[model samples]
Target: MATQTYDVFQVIADPSRRQMLQLLSEDSLTINALASSFDMSRPAVSKHVKILHSAGFISIQDIGRERYCILNHDGFAEVQEWIDYFDAFWKSKLKKLEALLNEKTGSHKL
Candidate 1:
């Protein structure tokens, strides 16, 4: 599979970045509006936005003098596909464990 993959871990690793994502998911916000929600400085918040932008998770749209941060959901699929890979493995393992437990305990509705 010749697919380009971005490091979702690197994008989501910071707590501040994670919070920024959560807010972005809920609504498109300007840099000032976003900074108000946290105690961090404007430059610090801008840095986080820059990382998210570089990671392709966000894009800025100019609305008059303000630039709104829009969530680029396409980038989210990177994480989703990775999780899907693990989900299949865990689901099968869980089913097998459940079957083994039932065998040991006997299939009685106690």
Candidate 2:
């Protein structure tokens, strides 16, 4: 069997990974610093970081002896674009509904 790969949504489904993103959004942190914030072992934290790295949500930098994790906007662009499409769809639907309601009530206030 082939090893399955996860997409951004699937990778971020884990609570730990979500929290890691939130932290990185505030400021870049070294691997050790990120590991300290979680109850899990350093290796476990590293795994989550790896997923985020692979998904393009975060970038790793080697600073001296430490590896720092920083937030990257490229991954979120996909999610944002998906949401924006639905936002426009809903806005159009709501406007049509409002027009229908106004026509029925014979009121232009709306």
Candidate 3:
């Protein structure tokens, strides 16, 4: 059987996964602790955690007997860069539009 790989967008598309990210954003949590917060079985939550881990969204570390889930910024870098690119793109276009509007209004004479 082939293993399934998910992109950042696809991995974050699920509400449960997004919620898991939100929770981890606040603090690191154990698998059992995270599972208890959701209305799902431990295995089910493990599946989501596994996906998040595989996508670099979360990191799992063993502290004695408990495993902790922590949020990782590396996974979000791509999303952030993409948004920043578009933000800059729109800002440049809007500035050009504003200049054109001011020119038409003769507001630059002052």
Candidate 4:
């Protein structure tokens, strides 16, 4: 069977998945340990974990008999790049507005 692909944003769009990321942020966790934190069934949690893993947000490792989920930076880097672009865009616009306001008010305090 062919592997399925997932968009980073789409994978994180679900609240459960987002929470899973937050939980994993503190430390790596086994699949069962992670599932216990949620109200959903093990299969449901596993499904979300699979999506997160496929989207590059997480990596699963086999430690003896348990599978551990660890946070990965690859997916977050894409989101961060997008946010940084907008941050620069907004800063430029705000600087222009500040300059215009200073010119009109005859003050550069701001």
Best by lDDT: 3
Tens digits of per-residue lDDT, candidate 3, 24-73, equal: 99999999999999999898899999999999999999998999999988
lDDT-superior candidate, 2 or 4: 4
Q: Score residue 43 of candidate 1 by CA lDDT.
A: 89
lDDT of 1 by residue, 1-110 (tens): 23344477878888999999999999999999999999989988988888788788999999999899999987767789889999999999999999998987796555
Off by over 4 Å in 1: 1-6, 77-110
Q: Lowest summed-lDDT stretch of 10 residues in model 4?
A: 1-10
What TM-score does each of the candidates earn?
A: 0.63, 0.66, 0.69, 0.66
Error of model 1, residue 28, in angstroms = 0.3
RMSD of candidates 1 onward, in order:
8.1, 5.7, 4.9, 6.0
Model 2 global lDDT (CA atoms, 0 to 1)? 0.89
Rank by lDDT (best first): 3, 4, 2, 1
Per-residue error (Å), model 3, residue 34: 0.2
* Candidate 2 structure quality by residue, lDDT tens digits, 1-110: 33446797898899999999999999999999999999999888988888888888999999889889999888879778889999999999999999999797886553
Residue-by-residue lDDT tens digits, candidate 4, 6-74: 787788789999999999999999999999999999999989998899888999999999889999988
Cα distance off (Å), candidate 1, residue 59: 0.7
In model 4, which regions exceed 4 Å deviation? 1-4, 79-110
When 1 and 3 are scored with lDDT, the better candidate is 3
